[model samples]
Target chain A: MSRPRLTFLESSLPYAVNAARLIVMDRGMFVADFFLATTVPFLMQFLIWSYLYQGSSISRSFGVLSLSQTLFYYAFSIAFGRLNNGYDVVSNLSLNVREGTLEPHLLRPVPYPLQKLADFMGGGVVYSVPIILVLAVFVFIPPVALNSFFWPGWVLLVVVSQILCFTLSWTVAMMSLWLVRTDFALSLLTTSAAFFGGELLPPYLWPEWLRPLMSYNPFRFMISAPAQAIVTMDGGFVMTALAWTSFYAIAFGCLSAFLWRQGMKRYRGAGG
Target chain B: MKKYLLFFRLGLAVELAYPVDFIGYVFTTLFVHLTRFLFLNGVFDLTSTLEGWTRRDVMVAFIFSVLLSSVVDSFTPSIRTFVRYAHTGRLEPYLVQPLDARWVMIARWIRPGSLFIFAIIAPIAMLTLSNLNVHPTLLQAVGGLFALVIGAIVNIAVMATWSLTTLVSKRDLPTEFIFRQVMRLNQLPPSLFGYKALTALVIFLPIVLTSTVPAMVVARGEYFLLAPMLGAAVLVMILFMISFRMTMRVFDGSGG
Candidate 1:
């Protein structure tokens, strides 16, 4: 059809890229912009932590760790935000089905999943600029302690966690097919992961009782496990987390793929 | 209101269509809430009371802030209302509309999916409040709901006040971006802020009234009845009036 036809499958991918780029370049979400607004509060936080804890880094571990963790967070979050393989794509594609546009995607030249990923990464590092800046400020400062764990372990954890998060999220996104609603599924992941995965705050900060539960949860492996390994230099359970992460990523990825194929077989052309 | 209903229905369809996004949004909200919890946890460990509230009280206040604010911000018009519309030059269309544009703008946000934000945490907040053993009478419930209404008013006013800067600023984007960060203040416990900051928040900004007062009413026991609660609503209304005047001037390109 000579392509770029404004067809459902073709149109959404470009739109996604444009949208991501728009959000990033969006003057409101700028790097300098975030820094300007955040400086006072961050400084306030920094001052509060630095003064109270003074030489005792242990007191404000999250704040102290952020000195290094923040940088990694900024870099990883920005790059990884694009690499997110699920979330919006799942939501959008799911919408395409409900809206009766799924059939067009099935007709496309590109593999739909790959197309979604391409669209996501199109804007590249733009959306992450703010995070990047936040990280950069922390770059000059040393991480609280990095002597204990090897960099490779930290790297492996980061890579694995990202994989795990992406894999699980991708699987979770497929729920849109059979279900009338997917919000519950999404909420469940986000809430658990936010704490357990270490996105909202570090898992270490969670109460001791909560920590054990979080340690076993895949959520921690995705964000905090690697992050803590890098910043705290603790690798005691890094391998364990990585193993679980790998298991979930592969398991969930296969499950999602199977479900999608099966669902596609039952797919009636829209308005069903 | 009818216009709002129509827009709300439209929004519902759009939201329902992308149910998967509900999860992503939930995740982001979860992340933000966790961030606050950790902050409070650390601060509490460091020192007992930031101002007058205990560590438990502060935690309750934070959860209240996030839960209620999530409802107000998401369901109400403009998810990040001020910046999204103000920057897109989208606010202009609203001004020309015949109905109460501000009301329309505020009420335009209807994310039924956002309902999950409240549902997931409501039990938790209540459970925590129960654990704290602070009980409010039926009158307190009315008063707390009243505080939420005030919170809605204050949120709208704050958005509008930021809208005033949206009018004249050389860089509208920067203004919105700045306001976005300013929006973060709502997520925090007001008592942690100093008097000037707290007063500014309670009076000029009105952020304190959103979460703190209601939480106080519920968790603060008998004092909820007597503390200067009406002042926050009155203050926000006044700010709205002032910002509305500025908006008019800005609309004419005089101030903006």
Candidate 2:
């Protein structure tokens, strides 16, 4: 919820309120359709997966813990969905390079990445409230678990995982300076989540060969680790997932910064 | 027909303008199909006849989805999107001329994108069924082809109804996703008897006839002789045609 330290008139309160009013008047159907199609199907798929997991052999541990995992998925999936307020750094950079907007942001006090990050986080916070409320209900409803579920290690790991995802995406967006588009590049990062981030289907259902590598994959940190913290109530693997997650975060974050600096040198544009 | 061809060419031209889009679209769709095939692959690997069906027989069932998509492209290109034009007041322009609306609408879909999909669907299904095509009696292939066409017509009608609903309701709830589910139920080659009422409903509710019965006719599966099979298909088509015309009347008359 941290605001970028700039006093932009557009982000000012009066303008913001006006924007919200205009949005409600114009694009309400977009919200209704998104809820019905995307969110409903997401929760439905979660229900079916939880049912199947309980039916399988791991039902003993999974049955007791799976509800929280489902809730975790619902929360994080919504979090991820809300966090991406259609401002993929890569797409934005590609468009900026095309339209010559990057120079203005660069001239500003805030770093471009920081500016984008804050904007996305602010928007994500706005979206997260309703989504978090709906998802949290899964925790308290019938057969809910309320107790001291201490898994600080896992929570920290999820933070690291989100950082790593941000770095990788930012890096790709910066790469747009060098290339016209990064369709394959963006797909490579995002589709892994589709499979492993436990969104489309949980990582547990992956073929036997692919199960163990979930720890190495940066995705599980975003999706599986936080849920694992509550459901399993075991922080044993949380440290490991976090260690790798943070490692990738630092590694990719630096790489992206380096690439951005270097890519800027290659930037030839209609001078602003 | 010529008028429809022009509209279709417009769609085709739009597609051609974006060369890179095809690669991503085709790859993602093909990957989804592959994953679905893999899930079934695991099931078949574990069990036989899927409660009394052969592996190749199951493959035949899966092929129906690709075939249905291909056959229905002429009906609703890109799955109910043509109906989008109809309701958007765009179709008014098409209606203004002495155009065969159906031909112009369907023609918009004749392009490279679906051809890629056709390529993906045919190879795997054909490989599995080709192992078992045993020179069926001429009546049988004809019946299979006939049923397949009927299934496509029904899909178009149902999807047209879906598209028209947007005009009245003013919503877009992943109409293509609905088509995907329909494809899911129909494309899978497994039979669903003895499961429950819902599964039974899949058979005659016209989803299964799109793929299952046609595959059966191709494989000469046991249901080919049954009167209920063909009768159900013909009845579904009649209803679909009626529904389609009614929707057209509502939209065309309503000026929507």
Highest DockQ, which number? 1
Relative to the real complex, the DockQ score for model 1 comes to 0.23
TM-score of candidate 2 restricted to chain B?
0.75
The sequence of per-residue lDDT tens digits that candidate 1 reaches over residues A1-272 is: 58454665565567457756665655553554445454433434443444444455345455445453554543343233323324555556656766677777667766676565556545433544543454455444653433445657655665565556656776776766776355456545544554455543445555667677766676666655654554445666667767887887788778878877987777675543
Model 2: pairs clashing at backbone N, Cα or C within 3 Å: A90-A173, B4-B104, B8-B107, B8-B108, B49-B53, B61-B189, B62-B189
List DockQ for all candidates. 0.23, 0.14
Model 2 lDDT tens row, A1-272: 99767465443444335434543443444464355434554544453344444434333443244554655665556455433323255656776775666787787665777666554443433444444564467556645544443445654554465566677678767756765444444544444554455554445545678667644566666555555554555656666666777877788789988998898888876522
Locate the minimum summed-lDDT window of 10 residues in model 1 chain A: A76-85
Structural similarity to truth (TM-score) of each candidate: 0.64, 0.62
lDDT of 2 by residue, B184-253 (tens): 4443334443346434644555554567777677775455423554565566656655665665666642
lDDT of 1 at A191: 49
